[model samples]
Target: MLEVKLHDIGEGMTEGEIIHYLVKPGERVIADQPLVEVQTDKMVAELPSPGAGTIKEIIISTGTTVAVGTTLLYIEGEGSLEPVSEGKASETPKEEVPVLLKEKNEFVSSFNRVLATPYTRKIARDHHINIEDVTPSDPSGRVTEEDVYRFMKGEQLAENEAVSTIVEPEVLAKPISPDEIPFRGIRKQIAKKMTKSLFTIPHVTHFDEVNMTNLLKLREELKKEGVHVSVPAFFMKALVFALKDFPVFNAELDEENDRILLKKEYHLGIAVDTKEGLIVPVIHHADKKSIQQIHDEMKCLNEKARDGKLAAADIQNSTFTVSNVGPLGSTGATPIINYPETALIAFHKTKKVPIVTENDEIIIGHVMTLSMSFDHRVADGATAVAFTNRFASLIEQPNKLMLEMI
Candidate 1:
């Protein structure tokens, strides 16, 4: 019998809820075929079968939260399981690690088990250190937290590392509540990522409003031609056109060496707000799509996202992102740059604002703001401003909608 354990479906993800099982007991499954659907904090993901076999048992049920090493199913196979060697993509169950470590020493339990966590083990392996060599000082013979930490700091570990001999000073023994509450669900994930990005990359936001009356009129014209379009669809079309003239805004930041990577194609990420959280699905090759095509795509995506049918692939890989808060009557607000991407444009609610024509005649016209936030490391203030200006010009002139056709 082959036990199928939960694997890390994504980077930085440690747990997932078993949302569904595609197969039942005694079902014959093919290799690489989907076995179950797991919902992480981000999206619902499908887990594929490891090999062709008949499922013998289903261990975890729907709505059950399982960690990386938790076994979810067992399969009866014809061949015996072979031990995976180094350089193999296959991963052994967590149970195998302790069994292997026990062979080296019966006291493998003594070292702080904290270091035995998958992430810590991966970190140790990346650092080219053997976990067995590190000794745990905890009373239960389990590796104490300090042993792993000290090893990471390059402190020499004896043949048998000693657990701490002395207790902590009284000053360190106080129980204190944290000032900031821990975040849960999507908000927490967003908080952690945004904080990391904000600190790692220097960000600057540029705000500018556009006269959207022309675009509004254009949308009406399209509706008359049997095409329904949202303000976001129009914005997506305009942004795609604007990218042709301002490719730098569609670039990414290389933080490790401090450089910018300018991509040739534009894959626009449309931010969709769901009851659970926010998801941005990319419209690949958006620059090549027509206004109506963008409209249809947005409509399809919006419907799928709102209905919770969004697949994992739909929310991944975006060259740039667009956040339209204008529908909520927001005039203007700064948005955080979606990391890796150098910029994201925040759109405000479009409304009729009084404007004086070149003839000096004052009239109420459609006006809106496009707030652009960018990584200063990848783009300076001037580039961001110039890009917004191009987008603004396109929004003010309804005839530019024709530009998408050409």
Candidate 2:
């Protein structure tokens, strides 16, 4: 028997929601053919058949979220099959996987005869609640994520209100528009990240305005000289210098080691809003790249993000992040920091507005507002203010930004 479990495909993927199974039990499939469609926190992936065989049993039902190592299904290879050899399971007989739950039962259960996913069982274990006693709202007797949370709230099992679990993956024929959106895939992943960042980090956001007159003028000048670049690219270059001055803002808190580790390399994460959700693609070592290089690379990353073609490497290891929402027409926003990264800066709407000059004169200038959010535990407000001020100065005088290149 071939025990096919969810493979650890990428960084930070612990579990995935079974979207649908491409193949059904008792169906013969070829090697590498997609067996099941899964939606992880990162992307939608197809778990393929280990070898050509007939799918024996689907352990995890559709719409259930299970941990990485939990078995999804069993496959009977052609002729005599070798047992699973990945771990200690190799020694265990194949009978456990096929017959542990039951022959005719649709819902698979753990050794305790509890119809619950590994994650649901984990929740029960963490709270010291015996999962066997919790009444499943799923008519099939399978426990759900919400059922566990409701139980924690002192909700009674007999009054279970969790959504019905999908027992078979093949019933759903086509995607249909529904009024209520199921918060399971990317949205759920985003909620988890946002909750973790908000609860764990002490957030402090500072708002400031930048004089974009010089930067815009410089962009035009460069364009006239056949050197094309973007305004955000220039802003990113200016931020590199500001980060150099306030290195603490670019540092991550090593909670385990009880120290703040300052990062020397500048890997800037650019947050791009897509149809699915907000995705950040990193520009590694931005400090070493020119304004044109930054512009070109940022464009390429943004395109890939829109098309949903960004790979795992495109989004990892960002020391700091920036959201340029100016084109989207936002005056300011308190952007969330990519967790583990100390700070994130958002550039908002730029408009031709009246400016009060130092010489007591009013002049029309291009101005953009910025919101800088940082982990207050790592840096103080005074430091954040100085950092934004430096960024503003660099934009006010492109020559100083040019000097930063040197």
Candidate 3:
């Protein structure tokens, strides 16, 4: 028999919520097959099988949060210990990921069956509602936000019994909206992580306006030959180049040791907004990819992120994060750090502005704000200023970026 333990999904991710199991006990699995889906504070990922064998038992279930090194499952049979020598590299398995619950059954009243965290359950109990009566929208039938609203309404109804008896449902209401949304699965994990991020970290933001007129002109000139370019692709390319010049921005923080760990490779994370929430998919070795390659890869990652088809690997190991709010008409924003990275850069809406040249010539120019948030503990004001200045210089000099590309 062999046990598969959860390894380090990423730095600082000590625990993850088990979303679900793809395979059941007594089922056959191949080497590299995904056994469980887990949602960490940073991203959602699938844990894979190390060897081909018959399934033995599942140690965790949907909605249960387990820590790193937690033995998730056991496999029994031939080669389970030795591991199958399949030379093929594992790809994230393709499957319809259900939201953080098992198959829906009639609601259970026991607190054990409720998928809420300790705090949520406490709130529900204080509100005097049966937790089971709250219907969950998640595939696991886990209670959600709407469920809480419903329970609260039930409490209000009990308090105003006289009005409830007189009010006719059809006469007073135009379709009662869903009342409670249960906190279960990835959504629940996202909430927990964001709450922790917001509260635990003292966040501050700095903003600057950048003139991208030259870069835009260069991109338009390239578009004639069907060499399409996107703003993010261009920004990422320039940012990577700037990082090479200003290495301090690329470093991560080791809080316990009170040291800065500088990274050699530039892995840029493109924040992909989805229906579930915001997911940042990392493009590994981003500095090495061409503009076309970055464009194509970003397209694929963003599609998967939106479709919820992303695997665990899709969301791991980002050295830096970029949150582009230009698409949403945002001129500027204060972005929260992904943590340990020490900084995050946000792209804002680009527009035209008037500029006066050294020769006393005034002309219309394009401008955009590049907002940056840094961990004060790691990066000082001087370093942040130098990094942003270098980045802005590169963006202004489109020819330099083009030459670096060649």
Candidate 4:
């Protein structure tokens, strides 16, 4: 018999929750066939079988959390003899096995069940309503007190002949006991990294606005040529040039060694917002790619991130990072620096605003705000400001960017 064990999936990953078992006992499976789906701190991954054989026994049931190197199951291999314990099955209760399996299934399903606070449950009980009947609208899948009240009001409206009235805003603000969500998976990982970055790095933010008139015009011209360019693509291209001029921005500070590691290759990490949390996927050799190429790659990465299909390699080894909140309709944000990397750039919404030209004449122009956060330990304020100015210049003078494309 061959023992199948859970292996280490990635760095710092010690354990994983078995979301579901793809194979059952006595089922035949070939090498590389997925045996189970495991949810780690970063993403969900399918663990494959090691060799072709018939599954003999499942040691760990579904929804159970196990550490690395734990034996998950056993497979019958060639020349394997039947265990002597098979004859002693009468000693074990046949009815108990099915009961145990049912219990495990119930445990796994419980994780996805509706969650509500004690106060919210009390409100539902007082109104003689089933808490499970109420739908949760919170992103975290928790049923709030307001949700209970809304359901009760809806039912009242349907029973009475009178017209329905809007729910008062003041009622929604009533205090209630909050549900405590367990810190696990991607959300927990993000908290750990953010805490480390905030406490260890001295972050200084530089805010500036760019007149994106020429940049917008360039994008429109590209669109006419059958090339779709996004706002981030423009900033990515401009960032490449800025990094070349100011190498320090693309470097990491090795505090223990007391030296700066200036990266020769440019791997830009684009921050993607996912339902689970934020994940950054790196674009290898970004400096060598065209703006259109960057846009295409970003789309692919963003899709993978949202679908929880990103591999470990997709999120590692980034020289610099960029995050854009413009798509969410934000005007600006003070972004935190991604750890180890010296700097990060944030992009905000673009709008038409009045600008003063050289002749003191006021004219409307497309404007976007750019925010840069840098590690003071690695670079001073002047260096960060100079890099931002160069980046802004590239957007203002689109002709220079066109020349670089050649």
The sequence of per-residue lDDT tens digits that candidate 1 reaches over residues 1-406 is 6678888765346787776676788776666767786766566667887765567889998767778889999876423255332224245466665654554353221212232332233335445566677776766554433566788776445432443543557536778767873244444456666787788778789988788777778778878998787777777877877777888888877667777787888889888887556767778888778767888898888877765567666676688999988778887777887776888898887777789999999999977777888887777898878888887777788676666557
Candidate 3: segments with Cα more than 4 A from true spot: 1-12, 22-35, 42-61, 71-178, 195-202, 404-406
lDDT of each: 0.71, 0.80, 0.73, 0.78
Q: Candidate 4 overall Cα lDDT vs. reference?
A: 0.78
- Candidates 1 and 3 compared: the better one by TM-score is 3
Models 1 onward score TM values of 0.65, 0.73, 0.68, 0.69
Task: List candidate 1 segments past 4 Å from native.
Answer: 3-37, 51-74, 78-185
In angstroms, the error of model 2 at 21 is: 2.7
Taking the tens digit of each residue's C-alpha lDDT, what string does model 4 give over 189-248?
Answer: 677678879899999998888899988888898889988878788789889999999999
Model 2: clashing residue pairs? none
Tens digits of per-residue lDDT, candidate 2, 1-406, equal 7889997776567888887676678877666877786766655566777765567899999889899888999887543345444353445567665553353254332224456553455457556677777879989988876787878777434334442343446436557667776677656777888888988899999999888898888888888999988888988898889999989988999999999999999999998887567888899999999988999999999987766567768887789999989898898788888888899999999999999999999999998899999999999999999999998999999999888788
Per-residue accuracy of model 3 over 1-406 as CA lDDT, tens digit each = 6677777777457888876566788877665777776767645567777865668888876778878888888876332234432332132123411211121122231213456433344346557666677777679866755677777887787778866667586546777678886676556766776676666556667778788889888888888877887978888998898788777678887767888888999999888876566778889899889978999999999987765566567777789899999879998777878765768899989889998887999989898887898777666777777788878877888777788878
| Model 4 residue 58 CA deviation in Å | 6.6
Task: Answer with 2 or 4, whichever has the higher lDDT.
Answer: 2
Q: Give candidate 1's error at residue 337 in angstroms.
A: 1.5
In model 4, pairs of residues that clash are none
